[model samples]
Target: LPKTSNREAQKIVLRIKRKCRETESEEVAVSIGIGVATKTEPEQSIDQVLKEADNEMYQNKLSESRSTKSKIVQSLLNTLTAKSNETKEHAVRMTKLAFDFGEKLGLSNSQQHRLSLLATLHDIGKTTIPEEILKKPGKLTDKEWEIIKDHPERGYKIASSSQEFAVVADDIYAHHERWDGSGYPGKLKGENIPYLARIISIIDAYDVMTHDRPYKNAISKEEALAEIEKCAGSQFDPELAEKFIKMMSA
Candidate 1:
């Protein structure tokens, strides 16, 4: 093919790949390769050009696989935000607070990134709850509360389903865990709980307390902070809660 035509073909192929990433469709696994050699180059073998294009396409496929998982997780979170009573603004606020707390604790950059993602998607499992149960304007029955408590495990399964998210799965699973071995699912205590999970637990609770819910009035920020302090060493990790309070104050 002519060089101009070859360039145009490459553009089209690249555009398709971009669309695959945007849509995050299952068809992304289908690899397509295009090799174009200048019609004027009689010496260049078609086989060599084909091999080069195939190799490039293979590399792109590998990259897309990694990006695909991230896109899927992100799409799930978007759906959760849209469907649940939890507003996207709440997720954004919690993420910022968690990130800031992680930074104040001197966590590594990678740790902070993971904490941020966990905070943003921590309540994603709530999407699995029935709308009637989730949006009930009154108090929940024991059975309904039991069903609601299963969200952390459900979230863990969703996150761990992808290799890219497996690292954070435990954190998601244990976000509700208490420091005194009283929390649900695993009831992991102290350092036994994933560190990021503990951090998220404190921030998540604080956010919920400060924000108005359908069932409860929003408390003052000071009252929320005081409530968090009151729960330190029981519902929360004492040290982390203290550090988080300080970060919020600062």
Candidate 2:
């Protein structure tokens, strides 16, 4: 322990974790959180050293928890991304657009963070849908369209499954809701729709309009903006649609 630096201590902890995983059984998953605290002076009491180590250990545990949750969330995203490259790219573009729009709307840091997550995971439920339906080149039949419409509820369930995603679960569920209460999966109308979900709804429409899909060709940004403007009161929140248009136009 005399010559051990923090780096060496971390290395030891990692080795222990590796060994634990190596020997873990199906019935017993292995995991550990460790911390290192060095005594810089011989005069430091044993109690003080122990307290420091304890604090570090608690911090390490929290870090591990966050890291594990993130891995679980990323794995879901990976699954979604593997199924559809367009969805992956759409999420990336929507995240930036959502974050930027949130800032423009003067959303709090936490609100913006949640908006980003909502944008990224909004279509995750599509992972469960058949690839043929997702990438179909022609118009969907009523049944296929019904299956497509179920994604918001499906996404809500998926997002709700993990603590990491629980914060945005409602937003994901309501993302497809329209301003006039015509949307499915609850038909939430106006401000009854969650604010973040409202933002996502606009962003989702805009992104879809401007991007090519197997079923439809991409429209010009100007044309998309006009369509958004036309649907301002019915399909989208009027004020938000106006603001989004201005933001994109700028």
Best by TM-score: 2
Report clash pairs, candidate 1.
none
Error of 1 at 9 (Å): 16
Candidate 2 per-residue lDDT, tens place, 1-250, comes to 6688868887888888899768755334455677778777879987897798889889988877665655556666777777789999999999999988999999999998999999989998887799889889999999999999999999898777677888999999999999999997999999999999999999999999999998999999999999999999898999999999999999
Residue 151 displacement in candidate 2 (angstroms)? 0.9
TM-score of each: 0.73, 0.74
Predictions in order: lDDT: 0.80, 0.88
Cα distance off (Å), candidate 2, residue 230: 0.7
User: Runs in model 2 with CA error above 4 Å?
Assistant: 1-70
Q: After superposition, how far is residue 110 of candidate 1 from its true place, in Å?
A: 0.7
Model 2: residue 22 alpha-carbon error in angstroms: 6.5
- Candidate 1 per-residue C-alpha lDDT over 1-250 given as tens digits, one digit per residue, 9 for 90 to 100: 3455666777877797677546544322333343434333777787777777677777776775566566666666766666664657788898888877887899998998899888877776776787777768788999999998999999998788667787789899999999999999898999999989999999889888998776788999899899999999999999988988887887
Clashing pairs in 2: none
